[model samples]
Target: MRAYLIAAVLLALAIPVRGQAYMTDSGRAEFDSRVPLHTFTGTSDVLVGRISLPDSTVDFYLDLETLDTGIGKRDKDMKKTLETDTYPFAEFFGKLVSPFDPAGGTQPAVVRGTFTIHGHSQALEVTGTLEPTDDGLRLQAAWELNLDDYEIKPPKLLVMKVDPVQQMRISALLLPESESGT
Candidate 1:
């Protein structure tokens, strides 16, 4: 009986203790770029992301081909300009800088991470809100990025060109990995 108890304690100690990990494959990411004469908006609903609760680590990625700007020609041009053929995906890996309480209501948080686009990576800090849901957590964030910083040249039309800076927004609902069904 003594040996059994000792073995049980050792087995329990060997078990890994980990925070809940949540993931979502249908998240959304959007970008808006406007000029005086033209306004361009692109959206991708194929974003995949994971968030580790308690630890406050998060990662997300979306295929460049998933972006739709409503115009075929414009989408093709943008894809070519971004060199999507070479860099297939845009990804972000970050950690929450502010303390998060999962049981608490919506809380403001800052996520510091690296944003990789078109084969270039840049350090970025984004302020967003985090809220607990029945499944897991919901995150909403908005930030601006400059095209020049990523070595992406602004696309031009006949008389107007897209703004050098673009507004980006992300909304994701992540369910616990165990409940994500894949």
Candidate 2:
């Protein structure tokens, strides 16, 4: 019993922390949208993701409610437009289109999979770079998203309209499940 307890404690303490962030909130996700004369970006630090080795599978999710555009009204309007109450998360699960040598330096990774948002799913292919870190792997990926494809109606700000086209990006440091403590 003591041995088991000590092992668990050691594993819990083995994980490294950057600043005050942990595996769950260490990642970043952002989206940029333009509407004629206006361009705004929404960002969140609560991106959660993982990359499976050997199989080369990648998965990530962001809580829609966590996104902030610096304006409170805009965030609420955006959530309403996204129907986030019904679908609170945007998620992607896909297999890497190419082989990645973990031993090598940073490499480009292509993934094709389904993206779900606003209760709708659409097929998408994205490209990103992956680099190995001492604690885990760091992955950064971006792709263009058509809100209409996800059945998201762009919100209107007074007389201004939000663009249906959104540019999305995510950067995450994914530790092994054992080290992640969850």
Candidate 3:
């Protein structure tokens, strides 16, 4: 028993030895509506995300209520119709499958991961350009997510509202951790 306890402690201490936390609170996620009739856009604050550089894995979360389309009524309608209160957050977790030489500067990379929204998680791949700036890292990519994947029914209030598909754009700035406890 003593040996088992020692091993558990050692494993816990070892996990953080090479792990780092890079958080970006101001990361912006925008969704655009380019249907033939109306065009809309909104912004949201990314709650928290961390990258395990040693393992090339990343997981992030966003507050769903942060969505804004520049119009008040539309926003209210969306919340009410979509039941934002029940599904307040969305999350994405995936690994950076491509080789990333952050110290070498800017380059293009593709990240494959899973995205969870409205309680449903699905596999997704996003290709984007990455630039390691003096302050942190900048990643820009856009992808289309089918609302049905997450069971987000098309808002049908008053008829002729909402789009069949959602186009999302993400621009995130992730700062590197100063040191890894590991």
Candidate 4:
């Protein structure tokens, strides 16, 4: 199926590589959603990303099913809202527009890419900070997304309803594929 093929390709992208390639592990991704009465953030540690300096390529993805908002019932509702079965992953692939020196200190970075979720894709440009770490690089980025843009209908029941706009953020320490210890 298409889903399986996409998953395979994403997995391949996360493999170890040589020369100017940085891979992410132990990364975290979060989406903060607000309702009239409350706000909750669904988080996951299975975030995957790769940066190729030679090509200025930046790519990232996370399994939707891996996210947990802390409550079992709410988590179930979220999966249903996201239709994770049909679109199992959220992904971004784009080019880095700003300079990134792995040996340098923290610097502002910009990336332009297409963010895909719920089988919908939209062009986006995100600004973040990239810092050189003892072992590799650390990336901190945040962006706002509207569920309507992805054709995702916000869940609603009784007086509880989720906001259509979500605040998305990610933090990852990217290490050279060789240094990532696979």
Query: What residue pairs clash in candidate 1, if any at all?
Result: none
Q: Tens-digit lDDT track for model 3 on 96-117? A: 7888886877777777899988
Candidate 3: residue 120 Cα off by (Å): 1.3
Backbone clashes in model 2, listed as residue pairs: none
What is candidate 1's lDDT per residue for 25-61, written digit by digit as tens? 9999999988787787899998999887656788999
Better of 3 and 4 by TM-score: 4
lDDT winner between 1 and 3, please give it: 1
Candidate 1, which segments miss by more than 4 Å at Cα? 1-19
The segments of candidate 3 whose C-alpha lies over 4 angstroms from its true place after superposition are: 1-20, 157-159, 178-182
Identify the superior model by lDDT, candidate 2 or candidate 4. Answer: 4
lDDT of 4: 0.89
Clash tally for model 4: 0
RMSD of 3: 4.3
Q: What is the lDDT of residue 56 in candidate 4?
A: 86
RMSD of each: 2.9, 6.6, 4.3, 8.8
Instruction: Report residue 143 deviation for candidate 2 (angstroms).
Output: 0.6
Question: All candidates' TM-scores?
Answer: 0.88, 0.83, 0.81, 0.88
C-alpha lDDT score of every prediction, in listed order = 0.88, 0.81, 0.75, 0.89
Give per-candidate clash totals.
0, 0, 2, 0
Of 2 and 3, the candidate ranking higher by lDDT: 2
lDDT of 4 by residue, 35-101 (tens): 9889999999989999887688999999999999999888888888889999999999999999887
Clashes by residue pair, model 4:
none
